[model samples]
Target: MNYKQIVQYGVLIFGAIILIGLVLKGNISHEKFDSEKWKNWTETESELSLRWDMMNSLRNNHELIGKTRTEIIELLGKPDSETKMDFRYYLGMSKHGINTGSLTIKFNENRIVTDFSVWQG
Candidate 1:
């Protein structure tokens, strides 16, 4: 074929490959959360943790709105850092790969979880 036709075909193929890659990445990022896997994922390197894969499931299935501090620790293990009002657990690399992500659980005066959020820094 002519040079113009060859170039057009190349561009189409490249675009299709990119679209497929995006679809696969999206699917991989939403893996179901498993408590056993989560507790055992103790990789020091944030990027290696299974927590990234399970994040969506944890947020959707687990109810952290009113759990006690003891319950939180029992479920999620010890936090990387904690304060009087909150605990932070490092999840893994952010979607952008420029920073790490963490789960922050907030508690009230009764030491019950009031809210929680996931963030990337």
Candidate 2:
């Protein structure tokens, strides 16, 4: 790459790293990951540190068997995006310096959470 192109790429990467840091602050847990914790924190996210803090909140604060979408939103703030039966939250994933992935929450007709999954791209 030319000098200017390299500088531009460097700047973009640095900005991405900073943005990820902001988005992840206090979002994940310091403890080890466990299914019970709703955290699959691993290499996909670069092992930097992210805990699915919102998901953890749902598992801990609400009754997953019956919690409504509105109730969940109240705790996690607005979702990054949503669709007919799915809501998405982005935690800024980065593996080997490339960021991708998001958390997807699926709901039943009653708007109650059936389960959630991670989308690693």
Candidate 2, residue 87: the lDDT equals 82
Which sections of candidate 1 miss by over 4 Å?
Answer: 1-24, 44-49
**Best model number under lDDT:** 1
Model 1 per-residue lDDT tens digits across residues 1-121: 9999999999999999999998778536777887777777776654364787788788889899999999998888888899999999888765565566899999999999999988877
Clashes of each: 0, 1
For residues 18-97, what per-residue lDDT tens digits would candidate 2 score against the true structure? Answer: 99998776445444334433333343434443544344554565565456898667644567799879788775543424
Candidate 2 clashing pairs, residues 3+ apart or interchain: 28-51
Top model number, TM-score: 1
The lDDT of each candidate is 0.84, 0.63
Displacement of the residue 4 alpha carbon in candidate 1, Å: 29
